[model samples]
Target: MWDKQVMKPVSEPANSPSYVQVRLKLLRDIATGVWPLGGRMTLSDLEARYGVSQSPVREALLRLEGDGVVVLHPHRGAVVPQVDAALLTQVYDIIGALQGMLARRAVDHLTRTHLRELEAHLARFDAALDGGDIVGAVAANGAFHGMLNSLGGNPQAKALIETRFALAQATRRLVGYSSGRTAEVKQQHQSLLAALILGDGEAAAQVLVAHADTARDDLIARLLSKGAASTAS
Candidate 1:
């Protein structure tokens, strides 16, 4: 169901190691469902996929395992657990609450420089949406949040939020988007931007949580449709 893939790389230090880069590439694939639920990813598959040697692949898997994104089996490869709709909903609920809190905190520290960066990402989102480019919109939306989440300055919370992103991306792949939803998302982005500019932490938090809530509904609706289609087929 990962029909579209959009990887927008953040700036990495020149000294960033190969293992880290491999890990990120692997994680991006996993997020977009290149690795299916319950699927096994052998070390050989990874090495071949990334054109990397054994050590970097092993280390990358280790990092993902630590993040709960994969589970390693001795002499076997890492396995992606099937994250069901119910569990995904719970994950989103937690994400919504945590990100809402992060949005609230971000207000105290958001500066003009940060706002300008955010505005750029937001403009990208609007452009993508206007052009009916969902994949581009998804990437732009992520860049916007990546910028916003950084504003919280809470690494612990940020890490927690990030671990669950792949599942959400998987949901996006399956659901795609209904007509008019992009407009709603654009409105929410506008509202959130306005709230942050006004230093209205509560308003910003509310909009973010609402955004997550919409995602939850989208996942449910799409999966149900998939089920119905399967039944008919």
Candidate 2:
């Protein structure tokens, strides 16, 4: 059971402006897999945890329900939505398409300042990978991509990409089971950044596609390995 008063905000700023503070907290929990797939969530539980009134908690739950992150039930309150393979594929596919477009646009418009920021983000990603901070690495990866997509100057496309990226984050925890792949992922990011810096949209798009495909392959392999272990047992 969650106590609203005792609940500490995790991701949002201390002075978060949104009335949906509870919603933001819940979203973070779900995104990070702290809530886990199909885990039960309740309005009362959230209210107690964040020390907020039921209004905000309820509103947050409704928003999450709309976002497809949570499913509301008549008797069961809300539960984290499951991430099936089909949904995962769709999310990745959309991400790949949008990112491909973004990369193409970015190559022509990418400024020196943008490259510098990307390089700095890459350095942080490298450090996170070296330290085996999977979460940090994931965040840095998103930041780098978000920056690239924002530079594309298409708000509608960027909005869609952002949603797809969030879905990817939700599914990424499963793939992140392999720590050995961290360096390779980082190297891929470096390659993509280099391509972008050189104003080669085609190369950057290819690299991005390859990177996403590799991640999907790695995740499938992990799933197979788990199944094999289960059968052996």
Candidate 3:
């Protein structure tokens, strides 16, 4: 079920030329299951829901299709696809490796200011998790990674990482976490932060890989369990 609070309009950027704001809102909503698995919705419905115009709605949906979150049909509107474990495995594997590369390269370039920014984001993550706000935690987690990925100064890498991050956001909503699971994630972030502060790129990369692996395994378990329950019922 979609949280009503999440459906509210996201704060927008003042100078964004493109409809990136609309895209993000749509991505977050879909990722968080404002529209459930395999659910169908037309552009008009999305326009009304997000208070965006037709073109931006269309653009957002097309971008989501590229990310493997939603599919478009000629006469069937847009539908969220069934979760594919194998595909997600491949995506996570590539993401983990690329993320490791980004972190490894970022070590030499990261400044004290960058480290402080990361610490701030990590603090946000901790507070969000403590409050049991999954959406906020996810946003903060993404920001933490975004800061690190930015330190590498690789635009292409950042773009790829953000895309994969969007896809992963979808999974987080599907595979909702227990408090213990959330705690584990928080610990992983702490470990990554410690490694970064020590200038241990290898250790940071290793933590990033392990973090992705843990997420992959947990999400697969949850999706499989959900499928089984649906089948049995």
Candidate 4:
């Protein structure tokens, strides 16, 4: 049994790969900024904290290191990588371009059913945000984009986007939303859907790029503000 304060139980089936599940939970926690950036954790600490054995915890940290989410220093152990302004700009730019490219191609393959599914995700996202369920909202937003990206019919492109998705998630905690920004997100979703419905690929692509750009700007601003505050204090 998991100690509630230290670990959350994984809901995966008993037959599933336990290590994968453990790794996923760790990834989610890190992505949501539950682990402080640049904070070090020893293998024993991770094992105890995640309620997993040494093997899985080690494997998870290794995998996270490969993904650039964490760095395994020889003497210091595993540390969550700090968010840097230049790195954020580059990653978000790539993400924005990928989103635009995917949206452009996806228009040709998307059907009415896909649009309906996206609409459902949008509703779920909006509801989660309104209820102040940040985790739920982030999950819903991811599902929405996952569905949209899947429609592109380019496996290679989709695969590349998935990598960037991981990078984006690591910094997701910084992208805090105001009420006005929440409304803006909803409007942007509607606009993208409208363009897609009309078979206006160019318009849809532009909307996708613009949406990513706005998110990038907001995140960078927040990070800067936080850095300044810490420096002042």
**Top lDDT prediction, candidate number:** 1
Candidate models: Cα lDDT each = 0.79, 0.71, 0.76, 0.74
TM-score of each: 0.81, 0.74, 0.77, 0.74
Pick by TM-score: 2 or 3, better one: 3
Candidate 4 ranges beyond 4 A from true positions: 1-27, 34-36, 41-67, 75-77
Residue lDDT tens for model 2, 1-233: 11244321123256864445766667656666777776887667776777888667777778767766678886556888766656666766777888888789877666677789888888887888688676777678777887888776565676566655565676666556476567678778888988887899999989888887776666656656765788999
| Clash tally for model 3 | 0
TM-score of 4: 0.74
The global Cα lDDT (0 to 1) of model 2 is 0.71
In candidate 4 the C-alpha lDDT for residue 193 amounts to 92
Per-residue lDDT tens digits for candidate 4, residues 141-194, read 887887777676555565556555655665665555655668888899999999
lDDT order of candidates, best first? 1, 3, 4, 2
The segments of candidate 1 whose C-alpha lies over 4 angstroms from its true place after superposition are 1-21, 36-39, 51-56
Write the number of the candidate with greater lDDT, choosing between 2 and 4. 4
